[model samples]
Target: MTLKTCSRADGHVRAFPLARTLPLLGALTLLPLTSQAADQATGEDAAGQTASYETTEQAPRSEYLSDWYNQNVTIIGSKNIRFGPQQVDDIYLEYEFFGRKGPWDLYGYIDLPKFFGTGNGADSGIFDNGSPLFAELEPRLSLNKASDMDLSLGPIKEWYLAVDYIFDWGHNSNNRQSTLYAGIGTDIDTHTPVGLSFNFYKRYQGDNYGAANEDQWDGYRAQAKYFLPLATFGNGAKLDYVGFTNYDFGSDLGDRDASRTNESVVATNVLLYSFTHLRFMAVARYFHNGGQWNDDAELNFGDGPFHVRSTGWGYYLGVGWQF
Candidate 1:
């Protein structure tokens, strides 16, 4: 018996400027601390000492940087709502620094945001969402983008570094490719009720099978994320928003060719709930990309010219655990 395949395409590109602004609007909606406190109350004593002593143990306290290295693990999965339908699978390992004197953390993970199940020679599904399709053609679906494995290390106080390896096994073209990456980021917390971070990264790809013009490429990226706390849900739930963008520069060709540029943006909103042993988070994301190198057609498919570009919008939800 022959197996039937899902007809959805893998990567379809669309643009919406309004969707990019939603995350910022959500960030501005966070409730103030005073309002959050009003949601719950306890009996008070006439003696000030009684009030102070009673709440001391429950008050939120600053954590030392050294607290980041304790052993822990996290797993997450996400599904997209677009026509082609995409999903992301991730696994992470974490460790914290000793003694809480300073915060230090190290983590690593495997990320598969797109995977086409085997059927009709496609690794994901029947249609390729990342492709530009003509209405009359039977959509030709390609395998998922690829897999990424990464590691991150940080001194929790302000700085962090991340390294990643991306693997591309071209299911249809019979080609393979890889890239090595490194990045750095910093955080600032002087302002109350808000926090900010900035990050930058670079990547280098290995040689293509035989195409001289597409043999290799190098690029850079920059991004930022922000946080704001809102009213708690019972004991430890808060609403927050995060946003980031990546800008790429340098050569889109091999060692001797002139460079090409690329850029992409992602915005998200999350409702975060913390527990003694775990943390629950739900997030929505919007992504967009532009530039010559951004189009799928510019993609180097190892042996020859492959018409493909990287641009789109997608979202995800996740949960985390702490030890």
Candidate 2:
């Protein structure tokens, strides 16, 4: 049985898994971040720029040996987010960034969950001391840039040493989670309309709700991330479709081995509209055996009832300001 973190008014104890990093509008970080001038790093509208994975125009290797960065802050409202079995509503403040320098490509976001109150017992609001904070960082080293090589062959344009880092600051030390994923990644050129990239990572787990898998080598995650510019308004507003899929497997955390399952997947699709300083996003996400919990698994712990029903759909909506 899973541990219940919150007691319900109906005399049933429930588990309130902190909404781990609601990545609603953060998908823009994948739109290749608008390039800045060599001197001033101010952001501009570079949605259909050469930084796209499906970009047909290839810049010379000598051009990108310097720094280019952009940052933004957004307020997002997300619902039915399954960090664990139970879905949660999260209104969070997120800080997102993307940068490219020399051989490096980086993207990251920090989330302060429940910046607005969700009366659902998990988070009271930002002013509440019990709210959690979460973040994810991805840094990739381009092999082609590092070696000054022409690595493109057929559909593959570039290769990278990719890494993903996640940190969840829960309400207490016992509720925290820190995880690292490291492996190889590649950008694929479809030679069509969309930009695409893929990564395969091995997971290194850290502190996570005092689970049996803590501080150990756990599993693998194969992910595909892609984006497409959809439309542009006469007023300089732009629309885009950007999404990512995470397939996690190869672990002892699931099925007959544990209270959870050995595999899971989360697929998120989004629609984003951007104006000069305004951003709006809509997202639909599907989760199967989320957080490795089996949908049919039900058990009890410490005289309390614990049920695991983790498979379902989740949605997110956000309106924000991009700096």
Candidate 3:
């Protein structure tokens, strides 16, 4: 999942030593790019570490691909995702890309919601004329690589100039969203197999659904993402755990509406499985004041009065081709 429409996932690209850190589900590179350019992991060591990934298909534009990059195309089915006062189900197509070349580390994904057009009545497909395109892009600049400095100290191995940006093309001002998060980031060398990274961002909101805070500076986000190698199978199949958390705060969302909150939190946990070209994953996410909607508040839906249920769990099941 690239979002709750707007939340977190971290990475899913095979681009990192451990992996790309997106639930940003890693986001919005087009589908055509990664297939010919993918690096597929086909071998593993006895300890479950990835031994190597073979570059497959036609190579991407050589000028655009230096160092290493990875991409995957995924289809996700999700349930109980809250939108305002309703919890809707959806299925989406996801395209992901991640890589580190020289001073730049990049991650992004494109989410085509309602791509399949079949879901809990609320679902619409891109092809079915029932959908919108949503995507997120995150890019980080490494201080160590850019400045030729040894920025590592203690548990932190490097520092980065980080940014997260999201876009959704909806039908109207109330249905669309565009946001930017800019700040600093760091990679933590746990000295173990676990990989940890954190980014802190100052938010600049844009086109936020006709809210009172639209097109203005608002809030902050603290995000933590992690990866852990769990087990590897004899058949070269592998299982790993990856996840991320987004803590959003310092907003005035509650001031204008009773059914909204000043802060929110989204945490995602994923169990991912892989074998050759195939992939499978299950995700459990927790939301508190999701979409900045209050956990318990009353509001008029125009047609009637209702209580907003903003806090709870959302689930996603995904299958993908790691091209």
RMSD each, Å? 14.8, 8.3, 6.4
Q: Which lDDT tens digits does candidate 2 get at residues 1-323?
A: 00011111010000000123233333222222222111211234545322211111354212432224555566565555565645555556666666677898777666665565543443443467643566667788999999999998789999999987776666665667778889999889998767788889999988766667778999998978776778665445667666677788997765334667788877777666665446666666677876776776676655667676567776666665544
Better of 2 and 3 by TM-score: 3
lDDT of 3 by residue, 1-323 (tens): 43222542111122121111122232222221212123334565454544235543464423333336666687666676654455566666777776667898777777776665555643444565533676777889999999998989899999999988877666667766778999999999988877788889999988776677888899999988777767766666767667677889999978887767789887777676665446677666677887788877877657777676778986666777654
Superposed model 2: Cα runs more than 4 Å off: 1-67, 124-131, 255-257, 299-306
lDDT of 1 by residue, 199-285 (tens): 566765552222233334456655454555554433334343333333445544424432223434444444444333344444444
Residue 212 displacement (Å), model 3: 1.2
Q: What's the TM for model 2?
A: 0.78
Model 1 segments more than 4 A misplaced? 1-67, 70-75, 81-105, 111-177, 207-217, 240-242, 251-261, 290-310
**Model 1 compared with the native: what TM-score?**
0.46
Whole-model lDDT, model 3:
0.63
